[model samples]
Target: MQIDVLIDVKTTLGEGPLWDVQEQRLYWIDSVDGRVFRATADGSEIRAWQVPQKIGSMALRKNGGAIVALARGVHFLDLNTGDVELINDPEPNLKNNRLNDGKVDASGRFLFGSMDTLEDGPNGALYRLDADLTVHKLQDGIVVSNGPCWSPDGKTFYFSDTWSGEIWAYDYDVEMGSISNRRVFAVLQGENFRSSDGSTVDEEGGLWNAQVYEGKLVRYAPDGTIDRAIPMPVKNVTSVMFGGENLDTLFVTSMARPPLSRFPTDSVQGGSVFKITGLGVRGLPEHRFAG
Candidate 1:
């Protein structure tokens, strides 16, 4: 099936793309532009929300708000009023670090990662936010930590260290909130694609990952086998998510960043949200922040 461009957002550095089932809307962020956007499934009724700093990701809450990963901390955002209150700040001393890709686990806890903004910093770290707003460091020394998807049964965790070019899986104990037995799940075998970015797991436990710098979205089986490839019209495919009433519609977000000399024209689908219909399995409902 041919993928169609739904909307031309023209984002500078588009990243997190999420689906809000209750509201039947899509939410995403422009990390560099510090803007959060929401729109309908057909790319209508677009609205932009301004944030004080760069936003990495956002998860809806059960109580009619959202939990957002801000520059260096997590905040509780009032959906109706747009008021943001800081909840927790990890690595406040690290001036060159900021929150990156993230999502809420099935248990409603937020799992996010940080990356080094400074050129020579020691990579980054992955963290988990518990029910009481306590942040715990799960993994460290990650260059660009992305994807944090859970299997259909919640038995496995799929994540990517974007600079490593490999997707890793871990045995997850949902009740205990722990991950162990880490193993490589898949690796991108191309020179143009440096690593995997945001990803989502389908109902059949398949992974759909955005191939950054390669301008493609790839589907893979649970056993680390390639299933199919969906090409995008632009480089820097940042993230993907399944939405729509039946959850069979795939939404993709891309970016138009530096090194413009390589691609002279900005006329491509650089910063737009594209949609592919009838090509995805239903995704698990997003966990809401109850606390």
Candidate 2:
């Protein structure tokens, strides 16, 4: 299916596009710009929040607020009052590390990853935040950590180490919040495919991965097979989410990062949100901040 550019925000580093069903709005972040943006379904009424530092990802909380991964900590944000409270900060000893890409799991727990600010540092880690605001370190030694999506049945986990260009599957125990039996799910080929960034799971347990440099989103079956490819007009497709009233619109976020110097001039669709209609299965609802 052909993707159409819906909004051109021209963000310096756009990522984490999430749909809020309750408010009927879309939320996303511009990491380099330190801005959080919200817009209507049709890209109208654009609103922004000026964060103190880079924001990696955000999700609606179960308790009626939002949780944002900002700088080196996780914060609780009040959507109605615009108040941001620091909730948790792991790896406080690693001054150069900060949170990266993340999402809330089906069980209403926030699963996020962090990376070393100074490139090549082996300090990145993945974390799971429970409903009670307790954070648990799941894995370590990651570089440029990315997706942490759950399968449809909530029995498997799909995660990626962007710098390594590999996606892995894990046996997820939701009740205990643990992952085991790690195995390679897919190994991306070619130098053009920079890395796998943010991702989401469809109803059939297929993983939809956003290829940051390749300018495409790929759907991979649970058995490590390529199901289909959705090409993007921009070269830096950061992340994707399924939205719309019927959950049929696929909302995509793009970036204007390095190795794509043509951004401001040659890149026409860079830093824009595109939508693909009538292609994807309904997505699970986002978890709200209960604390």
Candidate 3:
């Protein structure tokens, strides 16, 4: 499959890639730039919203609008009226931390995580936002919390602490809103320094995860074995989500960090969002936040 640059804009840290199946538009956030973007399927008619703070992620609400995450807290963003309602702040004490990757589950609950401000140390944690608007901290002792995704069956949950270079799977109880039997599902083996950034599952239960600094996308089977690898044009591949009309198109987002002395020349393609075509597998539709 050929990875095409759907959006040419450079971002300091472009992470989330959300597909609006209803409007056939692609949405994503630039973490460091404090911006969210919306664009047509063909990359035209793009619009941007300047968030007040660095946004980790966002989820579409069932009623319209979105559930937004930032360092301060999760807020119900009413785009229609330009209003932001505070859902809850999970980390009021951890001022050095900021919210990171997040997504709503199949049952309409939001799963989100936080990252340490310095980008190091085990100061991050993961939280789940229930349909009733209750916030629950699921796990602690994390660094750069990301890739909060669930299996197609909702029986397993996958997450990662980017600083650790390991993606973990949890035996999930979707109905109970709990996870257990945590274990490694995928590991990046190398001395060059790279870790799992973001992920999405295919219809066939394959986990497609981006290996940051490695410049590749790794697809792991349900058995936790390497299924395939696709090389990217940049060194900082951030996240990927399956979108498009048939859910067969894969939209990948990336980042271009400040002068990393080693990979100095790849900054051009690092921050652009890409679209991959010809993938035989389709993806599950995104779940909307119930609240």
Against the true structure, whose lDDT is highest?
3
Q: How close to the true structure is residue 51 of candidate 2, measured as C-alpha lDDT?
A: 79
Question: Which candidate tops TM-score?
Answer: 3
* lDDT of residue 275 for candidate 3: 94
Question: How would you encode candidate 1's per-residue C-alpha lDDT over 172-280 as one tens digit per residue?
Answer: 8888678889999997876654678899988888899998777789999989899998877886788999998888899899886632345333346788888888773
- Model 3's alpha-carbon lDDT is 0.87
C-alpha positional error of residue 84 in candidate 3 after TM-score superposition, expressed in Å: 2.3
Off by over 4 Å in 3: 258-265
- Model 1 segments more than 4 A misplaced: 118-121, 258-267
What TM-score does structure 2 among the candidates reach? 0.93
Residue 41, candidate 3: C-alpha displacement in angstroms: 1.7
Q: Candidate 2 on 209-272: residue-level lDDT in tens?
A: 9988787888898898889887778778889888767666788998766423532332867888
Q: How do all models score by TM-score?
A: 0.94, 0.93, 0.95
On a 0 to 100 scale, what is the lDDT of residue 237 in model 1? 83
Deviation from native of the Cα of residue 252 in model 2, angstroms: 0.6
Clashes of each: 0, 7, 0
The residue pairs found clashing in candidate 2 are: 60-288, 61-288, 61-289, 62-288, 62-289, 63-289, 63-290
Our model 1 lands, by Cα RMSD against the true structure, at 2.0
